[model samples]
Target: MRRSTGHPRVRWSRRGAAGLVVLLALALLAGCAAGPSQRPPVAVRGELLPAAPPPPAAQAPADPDRLPEAEPLRSGPPFADCTDDVLAGLAAAGTPVPEGRTLRIGCGRLTVPADRNRPDLGPARLGLTKVTAPGAPADLPALVVLGDTGVDGSARAAARLAAQLPDPVLQRYQVIGMDRRGTGEDLLDCAPADARAALLDAGPERGDEAAMSALLERSRSIVQDCYLLLGGQLTSFKAAGSADDVEALRTTLGLARLNLIGVGDGADAAAGWVAGHPGAVGRVVLDGPGDPTLDEPARTEAVTAAAESAFDAFAGACATGPDCPLGPDPRASVRRLVDRLSGTALPVGDGDSLTAGATLRAVRTLLSQPSRWPELQTALAQADAGDGAGLARLLAPLGGPQGRFDAALATRCNDSRVRATPGEAAARAADWDERFPLFGVAAAQDLVACGPWPSGGQVAPATPQGSALPPVLVLGTAQDPRAPQSGAERTAEQLGNGRLVRWEGAGTGAYPRTPCVNAVVGRALLEGRAPAEPVVCPP
Candidate 1:
């Protein structure tokens, strides 16, 4: 993926601390009943039920128990003292380190048994990277950044953030990036490539029993293969199990408190962290948030609708701009493109082509960032002219590209529960198609791919436990097509000391890059100041 171009240039102010504090305080007072709950229509109709309750919270596991224990925060003398050691290692690897910067980072492999559910099995070596900050304060916070699909970007992002942090803040903490259970260097050799290919071939349009059965078989094969490859080491790799992995990493690093930085499915892991290790968590910043507890069909529908809505917004904007390449009526142009693209396959590039399924996938990716709307509009215009090159370019990682589809599919399937039978999946997909006419058919098919996966894992119900920790900042873009603004508001209400900071635009919370939002989070973390008023960011 291309590096995010342009530094965030928004102004910052320390004066906003008091206001943030007040706002957070009020939000905490309002509590869970303060916000509206948009229950799914299916829930109201008794067609679905909530997930089962999670395991009871207790002390960290003290033995080689079946279940993994909670991870601890890393602590010791300031990381600066060890910088030379870290830098030398990086130098050996030919990785660049700025002058005057010591690479106080360490790499280690932890041998935790394959499956926590079966602790008697031999251990698997999980890879971990730790960076220490020099002169860290005695009471400074420690952060654990969770890796998403590919471990590369997250590792780089964490290292860069550590390097950029103020010395004082750096001295107060260390950052640790842990590869999830089955990804990165810890990837299992037995992972079936064919299973992944099978699911991908099923396409995003398959909503029938035959297609779903094929998808399920692939999912089941992957799970069994993973287990066998790991020597029956892990039965399943779910978010809850991954949370345990995080805790283990914390203990190894000697951290006293955890500040979880989660992205995408990592957000689910963060929530699992809070639920499993409540008091030990210092803070949480969940980017690209998703509700894991939502029923499969409901969550799929929500995401698909959000994508369509975002596309409509972009089209509307393009139609109003005279410079827009999609003629004077971009909205109509978008609809036309959608109609033509849906269920239609067109050559995209030298070897790749735009299938109906891939088109929606591209649209979903573009909707993730509002700033890219103009680019997407232009790409649509180009596609309208029968040249799919622009659209193909936009499909790249930075624009809308994805990593190995097989990996993503495998990871997602392992992380969630799926339908039991092809028949059931088909029926559900058909129902969803009617309900979400725009994106439902594809969404349903996407979920069906998991039907054949292992039937059981450690599934956790959504139990929002209010934190006694300091007030935490939660940000949500009003037009976020992935994690809806409403979910952010719901999360704020659920947390005891929470504040909803709103950025009224699309995509995940743009706080890290936005000086204003970052300032708020930084002050909150440093001074325990809550936002006094809702931060309603303007378009």
Candidate 2:
């Protein structure tokens, strides 16, 4: 097994300010997902496609059931014991922690090659956190939880997940959270304050030819700036590299097998790890995984449709609920408010103006977390009343350096070989605007931002091999605005040993939300078996 006592304190390096300017633009664009475009048959070369083959398919493991009977846990080399420091750092970073949890939280950092193939570039560090409930056994199996691609707070995400999980599961496993590359001290933040303000304050008008052209150019600039900032190390942050890091972490921990719970882009890393290291798989769960097969256009359309459905659901709930802010006709109220805002910006504090684009972005974000739907309704009500502060606060978290647009764009573009032309992208956004007006243009604009990204050494989504692997559980939410239910269903079908569990609820994920869904997950993880028939939990 790989071993390490700990890594020495390493000084941080800040990239040029130019990179921050580009990242700010990209990050803002990613939030509202509004970008520039042009009308031409010509395909712009955004990402460079370097030749790289997929990881070799590993043979089936000798033991199909890698989970061992309760036994003494093996003690290997000690990893960095930074638990207290990590907790303090998380608090300082303002990562949201679930309230009133008494779990023991341990933290550490693992230094791995920046690029295993290019070790001369030095090493990159991955932050780690272990959460265990009181009286949990020392010999319990390890279950690693992965966060979404956009955020660098997987450890916090794990803590939140731990707080929601059933007591029995918590007592039976030591939950672990591993940060993706470019998190913590490695975060890049150098954008000028004025530049960031300009992006946030300005209106992202959809279907404007000038706005489209400028966005396309900005995409190119961000890609160029990223390459200049990261150079050879840029490719090291790809999803495949993250997969390798997972393997390294597993080996370093001296675990015969590592169970995993991956959400959103994190699911991609888990799938990649399973593809490369099949023998190490124990139990796996993919929560709302994106469909890797779809190109930009198809993916956007599906997402837009999902958003339309979720909004309708939200509107319906509001209509039926007492004292609803949206009045009797919530959909009509939303359309009127959007039209008013699009024509004239609502003045929020700090000179920032709330536009229709930002409002829709906030709506989408709120839709992903159903618990916050009340906040969305109130924000809309205030926006209609000419108070944009609520909406601007909603957009704040979606923008800035903390969103990690630089890392997200690089990883997303690097994972896919798909590149769409400027004209094709713009035309799709226009079509979406006409069809799914509320979220169509904003969501569709995402297609153009990645066009200028350099794409050499990209790794396609892992194609799972071997049928004898243990069952992998995939959870899907009925009204997931980001990743649609169809995509999750398809993902479950794509995996060799995949099982589908549907939650008839509105949210980005299902696990630990409903007792019915949690029971299904608990059974699968603890007993290493899944229901023969697909399970659907009611809202």
Candidate 3:
């Protein structure tokens, strides 16, 4: 019930305890292959910016707290050395056919030890892509980083932001994305093609001890299998490995300093790296990160509260509309919808049936992006009217998170040293069920998905403090369920030099949610005087 604080886990796309072990072999996500240029992973002139947002009948008031003014770039030096015109020309000319997962971007494979702390561990390859900022001075160093969740398409994030970032932002730095150790070219996937469906069906059922036990056993087996299959290679997939890989990336690019931007768990990876090599990081920004300071139980609690709050916000938004399918009592309608579908399958278009699991997944997906709320309302209406087609459409493209479920489990487990037996997980879920209804218990159970796995991350992140690096800006979404604002607050608090900027709005990293939020971040990075205190950005 407490305010959530954790990873930018869309927790959104991942399925439950069911046959989550069915990881198929490593390959690029369906649409992520480099045959052609598709859209990219993420960034913003917009955080999936809205187009002329319609004025709500009753908009929330802006924060009454004092806001800080941004200072100029005071960092030691730029991360790159390149003329803005040359950079801009590259962008305008379009990304060339990339060498890895994406097309027309700066793709290169960087080699690092599978475990950097242990060089004798041998070499590992990291797939990385760079989107050169349009006008960056070749002599002025700059780099913006996007986390590569094996599932999120490592370079996709860089690709998405390359086009959306303001000219000024792009002109100053090159956006970089590297496939987390396991996902992209270095894929170690074991997830099945029907992995999503299997997980949905086999994941622990709320309040069912037998189901949860089964899930736990399966989970343990999955981890054991992974170890057997991957050997010590699995060790390299941990957060520490990723962080080291990042450091290696800078070395390969020959950048003296990296202006880091981390999204979700990517924040953790960046912070971890900064913690060790503070000298290598110049200006840093963490948006919607998973703070290592939180333990497993706390993470679940935070995620549960955040998710419920977000759902409420969404339902409230819909209820205000006279024709809302969820009716005037959106919360009740949501509960009813879930209850009614317990065992029944609604006939979707084309003779396919929609299960309760699929419905939940669809809702989760819509919740990930505030801009998608309208579509959610429509989907609900359509489902209520006996046609599950809309819901089906929403579920079809969603895989489990930015990385596959198994990879997420591996990375999460390694990061979190929390260990619980299946029975304990079920107990936690049972307790959370009352405090958080629909999402609370399920998430709690999911938190321990790696309980059965024996190996843990190489190093649990230290207190989000001690980075010799300059103060990094931390952005949090007050209502985000996936990446709670609390984590951001802690990240800012823990860092030797960190500042918190809170945005009361929709979206994971609400960078472009409002002019004010973007302005704060933009000015901080470009001009570069770190804000000394926390500031609240309005929706």
Candidate 4:
């Protein structure tokens, strides 16, 4: 080494190559004597070069607990003019227009694939109604309202919601209602009239194998007949597909994000949409949301337990009054009435009998609406008097949509993947009767109807663990007869970003009913800030 320079430049010659190899061997020996970390970086020139900075520390992934903030939704293209068609449809269905200050109303239908998974199923139409108030801004965002599956007519329900909602809410947003596919017609018409009548017989008495067998057979026949009649069309009716329909509606309406209020079964549809499309959601309120994640048996048990509890609450409330038809002990009165009906079914005109099944169905329906508790009392009083007309009147078809029962059955079956066999259904019914007593038998027996339905299809709508989705408001009614508070609790847990608000009351839903619930919902939707802690409302 001439002067032992820290950096040396070698000449491109045979001698330089030989010298370079010798120098590298010497350096390797020197490095082995010391440690690799102690070695300094080789200099490019006459100066020592700085070592490259160590790779940046690996970062932990984003927090899954924090919900994404809601963004302002932008308005899209103007909707088509279907005012006349929608008004005519409502009139034809005998649904009265909602009473409110409605300055303008727009209606349109979006034709979506019957089965998005199967193109051959052709197209199905979804009805839409947009209600705007007199003082509302034209550019206000849209609040889509989805009612209970099968029974609620979207346009009519939206109108009613528009009329009932607080003026501040309406002034800030226009309300839009959507009619799900497979509506407007009775799909259950494929079953024979007599078979349908036979299925309504819930009066074989508990432990009567013969009567249970008869009901099961009838259910099997009706379900199979409807499937055979509708064929692939029946498969087209799915809550998951309905979720996709909401996205189509959002795109059609030209909204950057959707603010939705889903009531009853409609909550499942809304949750499905939120799960599949998190970024597209603005604000969501699930009122008495049904938990589709539960299997058939679990769901039946939950509803039965809730219904039983609801009946207890209803009876307790009724017993406080002198005019209560259920007497001092309403529960006891109801049990006696049920026992009497089981022995001798009361005739309620139209060849329909107020059997145990019909009685339970009527009671279950009324339990969800406290406003109709008086009607329940009257029905019970009538049944106690050997006249089934009152109970039968309560079973009369709901007004909003036609073919409501048929639609409800179809959707219930289609949404569920579990189909109990005749034996399983009977066993479940017996267990339910023993446990729940009043409502369990009918609920479990109803499972037989879905037994004949096609299987291997998607069960309900998929609820994803959406970490980046905006906060979801899930309202649970403590004594809800249909959806139940437990279901709402489960739903809120399932939605990673869900905030649960519990209403300690007897009803199907909480919104537009309790001031506390309305305040929570209003704050969530209007202010875009959902409560971090769980909220509870008093009746």
Candidate 5:
């Protein structure tokens, strides 16, 4: 249930750049230098771990049973109909409604029943952004980009990509970005002014059960209060309901064929969209993949292993540094630090001190990006010197600059259905500590926090069937800390016409930055061609 840290916006120093080059060289040698005769295809085996049991059957379904089926909504002339209200809203939002253009972009609000099954009830105004391509064709291709963490950013990225394509490509495509149900501009603002203060004051004390329960109760109360203040306009939020929304948008947009691009948990929505829509979809792109079907134990195991591997790579690099930032033995240094932070409380400046919770937060942040390993090395060194300021700086962002942790919790809790019985949760943490000896314990606790969430969504039906859709280029970084490189390989293998493109260094694929990678991806998307062999980036 850990959220990925935002992509870092910092530039690499010359030394860091050189290090990256060397890392990439090593990765290329590890992955590609072997001849075809020497390299054999790997077959992954083992059944997925069993999923956690569904919430007690007594709880209401996260979403209603059925949604309204309506004619695909359209804008005017070039479109089927033009609604003035939709037009007005666009103008109000400063979105241009182009005139006499072959393609028309429209903005509108759709009122969906808070619960899909109850259409007779009042509706919530969910914002929609639509782009219509112009061409005489019976069935046009459409894609819905689901935002990974932020709706606004996703919409912008979708629009940017849509604009960059050729006129013919544009004419044959339609892209829409839905604000989902409860986030972005659609977030319910009914919580009283003091709700934030109340939640902050309810922080858990020493991981005590009583204190944690109090915190959960306070969070529930805040959400309930907000729901009531909104006049029941918004109910509980879940990914399944969001999937239904995608279907509704597809129908409303009038596209005969659909495609979906899902990033992070948004990938779950894409899978569900395909599952629910069936033959209606032409293709799918699951960036930063996470299987919606993975049960709690499997996901916990997968992420834990990925984290350990990434950390080990970082430790290896640190050990090679002349100064030996942490110590002569970087691996042992990490283990000792983790052990020290687990139990003892360290004094902090201004009367604040490092606790187990703070330590977990620091580890989570560091594990999110392998590229930041050097920074983590520096932070750990500072902590070893008896100043916890570096660690605190790393942990501060989890709550966000405004200190709102609820948003992160809400998104993660609604996305996955993993939980631990209080006893099991505690035991799992201890087990993780014994197994990983560095990262497993904190990850287990984070996964456990989602167990008691009231709204748990359905797992998307697993359809390992590959799409006959055009060849889609897939990219993976060997050292990505959050989304492991193996995930990219799995996704590519699952894709009917996918080609795995491997990059050796850290972070996610360098699509927006690396010209070489982008050129290859552009070829795949624009010309329906994939490289014959993996593109090896030189150091």
Candidate 6:
């Protein structure tokens, strides 16, 4: 929800289909998963127990990683009409779709209302790509793949998805990926470069009342600049509108039911979809899901703890690694490094210096991907040797190839109305040093980024819909630094037929990283059945 971590490279949420990209890379790894000796153990459940604990007695030897054999590409002529032409064609027709050749798979755009309530306000173009059902299309639900946040640059996401899909799935359903409304070619990059930089420089200046006031004013100014830059488009960039857009897409595609799968913040949109069309959706999947009902302090605190747990896991592994740059006491090394940075910034690159915010962001980014643990160790080691670019690579201003910064922030601010005042926010910030120590203050600082958000005239994304629908598969990667397992567990417990599938791992690769996970998900998707009870897959 914060702009500081806009770059997707370091985020728990990656480019393209956030869930699918991670899954594909992970599944490839799982086909030949390495042994414990080669893989660093990240905390998937709770705090770290020991550094480099002995391998399990029954552990089996691992095979070298190999490229997964690609699914046989279907041979066919591409879609007759482009996405825009197809949308226009559908609109010109009535309820029934054209017979010869409907939408197959190609790039297109959907013109949806900028604001659902104000249809006369004109429409925003949403980027889209559709993979039509292969061979004789079945009367199966279409798979609508969603990116975590409202980020774009996922023109290739569909291809990546096509590669990972089980052969059975490709023939049955059409897989769709959207660029939301204000992404892809329609992205709004109005915030001056300096404005985004300033956004990341937000902090309460050690909780000084005067400094807090200055920071609040600066925050307000940035928010105002964005509001103006968005040109009244801010209010409509929320999840509620995006949810309506999803419905429009469904109507455009002429599908009776959609297999809704939302990842990370995209879960909010999926929740909104179900809330609005409870009986219309089928096979709901929320991977790396977030709880829509969680309020502040608790939500921030939960996130902070989750992050620290992951960091501890990484620290433990790093301490045990023979050439660990963090030395024997990784925690102490980090504390000293942070303290040194707080006193004076380190030159990162091109005369740019690493600030506390950038440093923390770099650390958090590295912690999200356990596969990058060695890089984190190296970054720390490089910092000890007076080079900061290794960490600064994460904090550079960008969502890079996979983000729509303006839209992402708007989605958050428009929906989430922070009630904490500057003084109260400062109080929270002051307590973070004691509350969570490592990530607490930064977590609290993240909350302030939402301070300048408008309160009224915004609609809640989800309605009070019944959970008495079809069984939903919620995959929770334990010890996930961003979307922890507890949220997924709670979501499943709340649903009418929701089933919790636990994948014991630190990062967000539970579904694709474990062979058993792939089997479970493939069964659910192909056979239309999830385990009757909650299932657990141990690493």
Give all candidates' CA lDDT scores: 0.53, 0.64, 0.58, 0.65, 0.49, 0.56
> CA shift at 304, candidate 1, in angstroms?
2.7
Where is model 3 more than 4 Å wrong at Cα?
A: 1-104, 117-123, 132-140, 148-151, 184-188, 192-196, 202-205, 321-325, 347-353, 396-403, 458-467
Quote model 2's TM-score: 0.80
Ranking by lDDT: 4, 2, 3, 6, 1, 5
Residue 507 CA error for candidate 5 (Å)?
A: 3.9
Clashing pairs in 2: 36-212, 36-215, 37-212, 47-453, 47-454, 47-455, 48-455, 48-456, 50-456, 83-107
lDDT of 6: 0.56
Q: Given candidate 4, what's the lDDT at residue 359?
A: 78
Which candidate gets the maximum TM-score versus the true structure?
A: 2
In the order shown, the candidates' Cα RMSDs to the true structure are 16.2, 10.3, 11.9, 25.1, 17.8, 16.3
Off by over 4 Å in 2: 1-100, 183-185, 188-204, 456-463
Per-residue lDDT tens digits for candidate 5, residues 480-504, read: 4555666666655554444566666
Comparing 1 with 3 on TM-score, the higher-scoring candidate is 3
lDDT comparing candidate 1 with the true structure: 0.53
Cα displacement (angstroms), candidate 2, residue 371, comes to 1.6
- Reference-based lDDT, residue 98, model 4: 53
TM-score of each: 0.66, 0.80, 0.74, 0.78, 0.58, 0.72
Cα misplacement distance, residue 29 of candidate 6 (Å) = 48
What's the lDDT for residue 12 in model 1?
10
Which of 1 and 4 is the better model by lDDT?
Answer: 4
Model 1, 392: alpha-carbon shift in Å? 5.3
lDDT of 1 at 51: 30
